[model samples]
Target: MSRIADIAAALAGYDPKALSVDGVQAFLAELVAPAILRERERVPLFEALGRVLAEDVVSPFNVPPHDNSAMDGFAFDGAVLDTPSSGFVSLRVAGTAFAGTARHGALTRGDALKIMTGAVMPAGFDTVVPQEFCTVDGDTVRFPANALRPGDNRRFAGEDLRQGLPALLQGERLTPAGLGLLASLGQAEAPVLRRLRVAYFSTGDEILSLGEPPREGAVYDSNRYTVFGLLTRLGCQVVDLGMVRDDPAALADALTDAAERADAIITSGGVSVGEADHTRAVMKQLGDMAFWRVAMRPGRPMAVGLIPRSSAGDAHEGAAVLFGLPGNPVAVMVTFLAFVRPALLRLMGCNAANAAPPPMLRARSVAPIRKKPGRTEYQRGRVTCLPGALPEVRIAGNQGSGVLSSMVEGNGLVVLHHAQGSVAPGDEVDVMMFDGVV
Candidate 1:
C-alpha cells in the first residue's frame, strides 16, 4: 500500500463516524482517557477553582461544629414555650453572642441571650426569638410566649455535613460555589489534578500572526489563538509553539522541542499530501504517524500520531502524541472539536474519558442550505429567539473554510447529515451552540 493508504488504514482503526458526531465522540473516548494518566497536586483554596479533584474529599469535621442560631434573634430554653396564643413574657438578658464568636454564658430560667446569625447557641438554648417581635432594653427583653416553635431559628450541627463524610467526589471540577463550601468546612488547600501541559501552533507560511499586515494570499493566524483560548478555558497550561513553516527541518525542530516538554503537540495544516507539506515526512523520521481521511466534511484530512525523540535516551520510550489538522479555518475547528479536545482533556486528568461537546439542539433554519449527501457538514450560523418562539438560526454568509469572518460573527454550528441534502427554509436542523467560548 502507498504511504497515504497505509496511514489511512491505520487511522481507520480509530473508528471514525460516517456522519454522526456522536460516533466520532465515542471513538475519542476510547483513545483519550484524560482521567487516567495525570497526577494530583495540592493547591491553595483560592487557586483550586476549575481544577478537578484528584480523589474524594472528606470533611475534617461537621460543617457547623455546634448548633447555632440561623438568624439574629434570642436564644433561650424551649421549655418556656406553651400555647400559641400566649401573651408576651419577660426575661433577663444573660449576654450577647455574635457570629464566629462562641457563647461564654449559658441560659437559665427567665434568661435569654441576644444572638446573631451563625452564632453558636448556648447549651440548653434550643430556640431563638427575633428582635423584631420582641422588645429589648438594657438587660431585659420580652417576647410573645408563642413566638417560636421548638428548635426555631436554629441550625443543627452536622445538618450541612457530617464528620468524615465525602464532601466532594473525585473527577468533579471545582467551582466558586464549591470553593465556598470548602471554606465553610475550614479547608485551606485542595488536592487537585495537576494542569495538563499542551503545545500547539499554526502551520503554513500563508498564515500570518495577528497584528501583522496580510500580504497577498496570506491570512492572519487565528486557529492557534482559538485553540489556545479553548484550552485555557479547560484550565490546561498551554505552550504556544508559534507558527511552523512547511519545511522538514523547521517542522522537525519545532516538533522536537514540543515533544520534549508537552504531553501532546498539535498543529494545523501540512498533514495532507500537499506538495509543500513536510509534516508527514518529519513524522516518519521521528515517530509513527497516521493520516485519516475521516468520513466528515469541513475536516477530511486529519492526522494523529507521536513524534519520537531519538536523543532523549531510553527514558523517553513513547513519543509525544500529535494532531495535524487541516488548513481550512473551519475544518481546523471541527476536527479539533471532534478529535483533539477529548485527548487534551484526558491528559489534563479531568476524568475526561472523551471530549464530547454538549448535546446539539434542534432549531429551525431561517434560510436554505446547499450540500451533497456524503460528508457531514458544520455550517456557521447566527441564532436569535423571540419571547414566545423557538430559537431561529440563520446560516452565515460563507461556508468556505478559509472565511474566518463568518466564524467571528457566528454563534453556533448547524450540522447537516450525510444522507441529508439541501435544506429548505423552516427545515429543522441540529445546531451546536457555542456555549462557554473562551
Candidate 2:
C-alpha cells in the first residue's frame, strides 16, 4: 500500500486531477507486480489450455528423432543427382518403406527406396523425388535432375525442435497448438501459474438486476454480464458479486468481501460526479484509492487503488488491486479494454512483453468526424477492405456511452488520441480490433 504511493510520486507528472490515457497505463505498469512468483501448479496437458506457462518447456528429445521423409517419394543419395551423365537421374528401385515402420535395408549409392511420408530415410539417402515426378521402368526409376534439390522432402532430426532447446518459453499462454507441441515433446503435463481470482459487481440504485421488473428511469444492469464475460474470457476465476446499490455500508462490505477472496475487484458506476454515491468515500475508508477524472471520453471517471487483506495476516499474499469504472455500458467496456485488462494480464503472470497494449490496425476514415484536442476519444467503427484501396472505416450508429448495440455493430474502436484534432474523410486512424476482445 505504501509502495503504491511511492510509485505514483516517482512518476514525472503524476496528476490524479487530470490523468492522461498514457498516464493511467504508466501508473498501472509501475504499480503491478506479477503474481506468478507466488506459486505455480503442475497441470495435465488436457487441463493446461489458456494457462500461463511458469517455466520453459525444454524438449526431451528431437522432434522427429530421426531423418524422415516429408512426402511419399523415392529416397536416394543426393550426390547421384550431380553424377548423372544424362539430363535425367536414374536409380534402381530397391525396396518400399512405409510410415511408422523403418524396416528397409540401407540403400546403395544408385539405389532409391520407395518411401511414404514420415518414413525414416534409409542410410546413405539424403534426397527424395516425389513419386509423381519419377517414371518407373522395370526396376529403375528415372527423373529430371532439376526436378528436386538435395535434401528435398526430407525432415531432418531436430528440424522442428532440438532436444536441448526450449520448445515453449516461460510466460507463454498455452493454446491448442501449444498443447500439440507439448505432446510432440512427449510431455504429459505442464507447469503453469495458478489461475487469478477476480470479483466484480455493478453499483447504482437505478440499475436493476435480471428478472426484476422495470421502473421509470431505471435501466437493467448490463455491466455485470459484460464484465463477467470479459473476465471469463481472460481465464480468471471470476467471483460474481452481482449488483450493489448506492448505499455506503453495502458498497464497503462488498468491496471488503471481494478483496478478501480475489486478486482484484471491478466495480462499475458511482465514479461519476453529481451522483449521490458513496463509492469514493467507502474506498477511502477501506483501501488506498486514487480517484481520477481521466482525459478520455465515455470512460473518463475512473479509480485505481489497492484494498488491504483483512482476512489473512502473515499468510496473506498481497493486497487486491481495485478498478472503479464508469456505470455506462460502453464506458465500462472501453475503460476495461484500455486499462483494466492489461493490468489484469500483468497481475495474471504475463511477462512485460506479453502484457503490452494490444496491437491496433490502421484504417482510413470514411467520413469527416468532429473532435477537439487535449483528450482521447474512442468511437465505435465498422472497418472494411475496399479491395484495391486501404481498409476504410465509418461510424457505427450512435456513439453513446449506454449504447451497447453500437459496440456490437462496430468491429473495432477508432482511437482518436490526445491532442489530435478533427478527422477528415481520408484521414488515417488507429483502431483497436474487437475480434477476440468483444
Candidate 3:
C-alpha cells in the first residue's frame, strides 16, 4: 500500500463532522514523521539562526574560566571581619588589580586589593566592597561594620556554563540569544537540519495575476503571496509555481512537478465541493488523496495526502506530502496558521512539543460574539489592556471569510472552541496574539 493510504488506514476511526482541532493536528504529526527524520548539515555559527540543531552542543571549557570580581571594588579576606570591635573597620590598600592583568599576590590579613570589574579576584579573598561604599584615606580604605559578608559580588568559574556539559540540546531552534550562547562557547559552526523546500500555487479560473485588468467576475490572486510570506518566515525554501488555471492536464502536471522537487506541496482553492475544481480530481488520479470537511469556521474544507511521481513508462517512483487549503483569502491564512505552519516546522526537524499551537491568553470580551457549538471559530480581534483589569478584546468588523482586511487591522485572534456557545459581553475568551509583548 502507498504511504498516504497507510496513514489514512491508521486514522480510519477519524470522524470529520465531529473532528476537534487537536485531532487533525495529531493525524498530521503522524503523517509527516517520515519526511521530518532526515539527515543533518553543518553550517557556520553566523548562518545558524532559525535552524534546528541536529546534535547536542557541549561546552569544552568554563564560561568565565576563572574566579573574578563582579564589580570595581576592594577584595579582602572576610576572616578579619568575623569579629568587629567597633561600628567600622579599616584595611590598608596593598595594590591594584585590573582586568586582563596578571593576578596580584594573595591578600594578607588586614590588607585589600583595589579590584576592577571582571578582574581576577586575588586568592584568599572572599568578598568585595563597592568603591562608593568605602572612604579612601591616603593608602587605606574604611568600610562600615557589617557592610558585606563572605562570597559577595564575586563570580566563580563555570557559573554560567560548566565544561563538558551540554550547552544546547539537539532539536533546539537557534534564536538570537541561542546564537550568542554558542558564540560564548567558541563554536564556529553548528550542525543543523537541512531546510525543507515547499512548492505552492493558486488554482482557479476567476483568479487574476498582477498586471491583469479587473474584469466582471475576476479577483486578483492574494493567497499565493500570503502563503509565500508565511513560508518564508518559517525558514522554508519556497518554490512559487504562480497561478494555474482550472484544467485537468495543467493541474496534473503541476502536482507531478512539485512532487518530484519539493518536500511538500500547498495549494489554495480547487479542493472544495465546487464544479470547477479540477485540482481534486488530478490529486486523486496522481496518488492517494482524501478531501476532508473539517469542522472549523472560515476554513472547513481541507485536503491531505501524498502525490506520487509518475515514471516516464507509467511507473511511480516517489511522492511528496500535500496540503490543500480553502479558497477564501482569510480562510487560507487561518488554516495555514492552525495546521500548515506547525506541519512545516516539524518537517524542518523542530521538536514536536515546540511545534504545537501558540499559547493562548485569557481576555474579556468587549462585545458579544455570535457562535454555534459544533465548529471552532477564529475571529480577528483588537486586544487592548485595561487600566486595572485583564486585556479586553473586540472583534474586527466583518467576520466573513472573504474579508482579508480584518486580519490586517487586528492584532490578535479570538479563539472560540468547539462546544462553546455564543459569547456574552464581559465574558472571558481565549486570545492568541500575533506579536507578544515581552
What C-alpha lDDT values do all the predictions have? 0.76, 0.88, 0.85
lDDT of 2: 0.88
Off by over 4 Å in 2: 34-37, 313-317, 386-389
Task: Score every model by TM-score.
Answer: 0.76, 0.95, 0.91
Put down candidate 1 lDDT per residue, 317-411, tens digits, no spaces: 44566788888888888777656776666655655422345578888889888888766888889888768777889988788887877877888
lDDT of 3 by residue, 6-76 (tens): 66677855775556677778778877777674667889988888888988899999988888999999988
lDDT of 2 at 125: 88
Best by lDDT: 2
List the candidates ranked by lDDT, beginning with the highest: 2, 3, 1
Q: How should the candidates be ordered by TM-score, best one leading?
A: 2, 3, 1
Q: Which stretches of candidate 3 lie over 4 Å from their true place?
A: 1-13, 78-81, 145-149, 310-317, 386-389, 436-438
Q: Which parts of model 1 have CA positions greater than 4 angstroms off?
A: 1-20, 34-36, 74-82, 86-95, 104-113, 124-153, 210-213, 295-297, 310-317, 352-399, 411-437
